[model samples]
Target: MKTELIITTYNNPKALNLVFCALQDQSRMPDRIAIADDGSGPETKAVLEKYQSYLPLRHVWHPDTGFGKNEILNKTIASSDADLLIFIDGDCLASAGFIERHIELAKPNAFSTGSVVRMNAQTSQNLTEEDITSKRVFDAQWLRQNGNIKGLSDSLKAGKASQSVSRILDRLSPVKITWSGGNASTSRSQLIAVNGFDETMRYGGEDKELGSRLLNAGVKGQFLRYSAPLLHIDHPRGYVDPEIVKTNRAKIEETRKMRRRWADHGLDRHISA
Candidate 1:
């Protein structure tokens, strides 16, 4: 299947650079990539331009609107034409087998969500493009030496599990699987069926709301926590507002209570044929 990668970003060009370096080493490269830019500046555009020659890339950007991640993502989704869609944050560095594993385990009528190995601010700051390109950033020893050892065991367990073990964990894990925009994949048809993400959503639980809708529509959520692991670079969330959080949470609750299968303020309203 033709798979397209969608990475959401704001102004963190440094982190995005590392993410691109990581993607450059994917076991299975995506057919295309679309940046879901939420009003970033010239720095991000420069980063995109730097890698444009090496990757099949498209930048879907708008004016600096305040925290319109869902809106930008919806626009990116509409712009992509690949049958399969893989989503990740621009600050998250994919492991070498990330794309390969996602494609290998992809299922119909279902979306896959994976785990992240988070880097602290110090560790994130210290990482270089060489570290990402060589995948030394995912090395347990490197992570430990860099002060990311707190969750090393869990990170290793998730990143190194065999396919059989991963499948077993997926089947038996007690944790409820949710849609994580950072490391997840689903077919374009399934997303469109549910009208993509709800544009009314702000920041918190927007991804989860879309997942809830998919679940209500009988699309299963497959947990890939032990297989498709990625490293999330630390960054500040300056846009997170308590009022917005409360509003988003209420929207999510409403979607759950109503079992909404389609979003009124989603792709249909923004996407053109």
Candidate 2:
């Protein structure tokens, strides 16, 4: 299947370079690397220019335009020519066999996916070797080998639980939802039917909202449990709005409500695993 690796970026040239290096090693090289970039600094452009001469790459950029990731992503897909679309952060590095694994899972009405691990740059790990899968993640090998990566006994880690939860809000198996936006993939047709993503959303909740749409669409989602293990480089979780947390329950309820709305109107169908 013709596929495109879509990476969204904003102000992180070093991370993008690391990601490119990983892509170069993919067992199955993507036909094209479509960059969905919001307004990044000049340094990022320079880096991209250098890489463009040697790789099958495309750069999609827009004005700072304030919180326009969803919009940019939506348009990028509409303009691209790949049947399947794989989304990864520009700062992320693909496992050696990442592309091969995803292609291995391509199926109609079925979206193949993988898990992401979170890591930090301040760590003392080997950036070159460990960077094969992802730099930010520390114990990526163990997690990928075991088919799961978890953070310290804290809250969110690089494993099946959060990765699965981040993708979906309902109790759907296979299509695991996750909070981390590092590892996730779906078909281009499915995305277009839902109008891509809700552009109104700015900060967080994009992934959850998208998952809700998928569940409603009856597209069976399956976690590429053993295939694509991603490293979600850990970053400092900044202060979120008190209301976003306080009204968390209400948000879930609202999500369910919207899910019903989509289903009732013959819009999207939700499937169980």
Candidate 3:
């Protein structure tokens, strides 16, 4: 099955650049890519143009909603056209085979989640050969464009060995959740089933809520083992605004409670904290 990438972004051109680079690296590229731009500038547009020819790119913009990027993500996801949708943050980069793995298991009515490796913003902004070699960051410029994945951990190298005995014994999985916000995939039907994400969700908690709905629907999510990995650039360790975070957390808790109710009533919501 073919796939589509639905990436959400605002004014962050650098992150979008990295993400686009990663998308280029996929072994089997998507039929199309939908970018939900929340009022970016000419710089962002310029960067996107560089990759337009590589993949069919579709971009839509909403009047700046003033909130975080979650609402725009929902809108983008809703607007995308593909049987399989792979979602990633603008600041994160997926491994070369990430999309291939996600497409391999995408179900008509199930959501699949994968793992995220965080990189400090310093590493993200000023990435170097060391970072890519050490597996500290995902260098889209290198990994996506240049086929570079050197200097990764021995464990990762061991896990990804193409023709080693390690490949045989490495069947064990490392993904803990069937769904995570940073890197995940789902079918259009499964996402539309829950009416997409709660557009009202402020941010910071949309993944858990949507994942709950998947469980309630009895959707089977197959973790990509170690095959589907995402490198996340750390940004300030979450929200610093106490009030904003407090409010969002309260909403997040409410979302969790709602999922629990779904479980209690007639859903199979199962996501671990």
Candidate 4:
């Protein structure tokens, strides 16, 4: 299947650069890459332009309005023509076999969600491009020493192990499979079937709502938490609004109660245009 990667970004150029470096080291590269830019400044654009020659990049940008990640995501989804679409945030760096694992695990009428080892500010700031290219950043020991290894699960996720080990851990894991915007993959057709992400949503629980809609549409969820680990570069959450989160939670609850499938203000408008 033709695969495309959709990376969502705002003004964080440094983190995005690291993400690009990690993608350059992927075992299986996507056919195309789409950047869902949400009103970023020139610094982010400069980073995109700099990597244009090195990667298959297509920037889908909008004006510097308020938070509109889902809107930009919908626009990017509308523009993409790939069979499979992988989603990630700009602050997360993919492991060496990330793309390959996603492709190997891809299925019809289902979506795959993975996990991330969130780095502390020190780790995120000190990481060099060489660390990413050499993949030393993913080493469990290195993460423990230089970065913050939160728990045993984070170490297990980053460890270089056999596919069977990862799969075993995945099965044993109690975390439910959900649409993790930072590390997830799904069929483009399945996304279109649910009319893509809800534009009315803010940050929190927005991705989960989309996954709920997919379930309502008879699409299943797959777990890739142990198999496809990402190094999530941590940043401040100044934009997080408690009221918005509460509202999004209510929206998600309503979606579950009503078994909602299609998004009311989603991809159809862009696709039709």
Candidate 5:
């Protein structure tokens, strides 16, 4: 299958650079890396240009529209012809086996969801390209000694030993299987069946809402929380609004009540019949 990695980014070039550095070391590289850019400036463009040689990139950008992540995402999805679409946030650093793991677990009628180890500002700022290239930054012990560890859970998550535990936990874990924006994968057919993401949604619950629609369409979720780990580079979210989040939550509820499969305003408009 033609696999593509869809990374969502805004104006943060610094973190996006780090993300590129990590992708440079992927054990299994995607056929294409699509940047679902949400109206970023030149700095982000520069970052994308820098990694063009290192990564197979498809930069999909819109104008400086406010809070149009879903809209841009719809455009990106509609533009892509890849069979499998794996998603990650631009701030998240992929492990070497990240893409490999996603492919290993890919199944028909299902999407894979993974979790992240949140890096603190101190750790995030202190990271260098060398740290990522050498893969020392992925080590739980190295992080605890040189940087900050959120808790024991963070340590457990960062450890490579967690792979064995992840298989068990994936089946035993009680957490609801939702499409986490930080890390997730689904087939293009599955996404198109649900008509892609809802353009009306804001940031909060937008990813999960799409997951719910996929579920309504009889697509299941596969948990890979511990198996496919990512180091999330922490950054300030100035766009977050409590009222907007509440409104987004209500939209998700409406989708649930209706058990809707197709998005009212999504990829359909962008795709030619």
Candidate 6:
């Protein structure tokens, strides 16, 4: 299947740069890469320009409209022509086989959800483009030497038992596997069938709401936690507000109760002439 990688970002150019660098070593490269920019400054653009020559990239930006991630992502999703879409956060660096694993596990009428290993601020800060390109960022020994205390459990080291472990965990884990935008994949058709993400949602639970709708539409979610692990760079979420979280939670609950399949205020409303 033809695939596109869509990364959401605000201003963190450094983290985004590392993400792009990691993509350079993907076992299966995406047909295209899109930045779902939420009114970031010029520094982010400069980072994108630096990698334009190396990757098939595009930038989809909207004005600074307070936490419009869902909207920006909808626009980015619409802009892509690939049959399959893989979503990841700009703050997360892809594992060497990230793209390959996602593609390998892609199934019709089902979306794959992956896990992320959190890296401390110091580890995130010290990482260089060379480290990412060389795939050392995923090295457990290097990560441990550089302040990563979370060992094998959260490590991205894929082993021969990885697939079996992922399946076992998926079946046994109590955690509800939802569509995590940080590291997830679905076909463009399935995404549009549910009208993409709910624009009314601000931040929290927005991605989950979309997953709920997909489930309502008969698209099951498969967990790929062990196979497609991503390295999440630690950063403060200054934009998070309790009121917004409460509001989004209410909306998600409403979606769940109604079993809504398509969002009223989603991608269709943002389509350009």
Which predicted model would earn the best TM-score?
4
1-273: candidate 3 lDDT, tens digit per residue? 657888777777777777776666678778888887877778888878887887789886777746546566666765666778888777777666777777876766667776655554455667643444354344334343333333443235323445234233224545345457777888876766665665555555556666766775667666643556677655554434566556756755665566641323111121112
Which candidate comes out best when scored by lDDT? 4
Task: Count clashes in each candidate, considering only residues at least 3 apart in sequence or on different chains.
Answer: 0, 27, 5, 0, 0, 0
Per-residue alpha-carbon lDDT of model 4 for 13-84, expressed as tens digits? Answer: 999999999898888999999999999999999999889999999999999689899999999999998999
- Consecutive 10-residue window with the lowest summed lDDT within model 4: 154-163
Pitting candidate 3 against candidate 4, the one with the higher TM-score is 4
The candidate with the higher lDDT, 1 or 2, is: 1
User: Which pairs clash in the backbone of model 6?
Assistant: none
Query: Each candidate's TM vs. the true structure?
Result: 0.95, 0.74, 0.75, 0.97, 0.96, 0.93
Q: What does candidate 5's lDDT look like per residue over 1-273, in tens digits?
A: 889999999998999999999998888999999999999999999998898888999899999779888888889989999999999999999989999999999999999998899888888988889999999999888888866577756766687456778777677767888889779999999999999998888878899899889988899898887778799998888889999899988988888899989998898988988
1-273, model 6: which lDDT tens digit per residue? 799999999999989988888888777899999999999999999999999999999999999878999999999988888999999999998877889888887999999998787888888777888887676778767777777746556553333246667667655656687888899999999988899998888888789999999998999888877667788999998988899899988887888899999999998876675
Which regions of candidate 5 fall more than 4 Å away from where they truly are?
160-162
Worst 10 residues of 3 by lDDT: 264-273
Ranking by TM-score: 4, 5, 1, 6, 3, 2
* lDDT winner between candidates 1 and 3: 1
| Whole-model lDDT, model 5 | 0.88
Give the per-residue lDDT of model 1 (tens digit) for 1-273: 888999999999999988898888888899999999999999999999999999888999988868789888888888788999999999998878889888987889889988788889998888898887777787767777777767634644435556677667767777788888788899999999999998878888789899889999999988778767788899888878889888878887888899889998898867776
Residue lDDT tens for model 2, 125-176: 3355444544333344544444333443212333334434533522243444
lDDT of 3 at 257: 62
The parts of candidate 3 lying over 4 Å away from their true place are 128-178, 236-240, 243-273
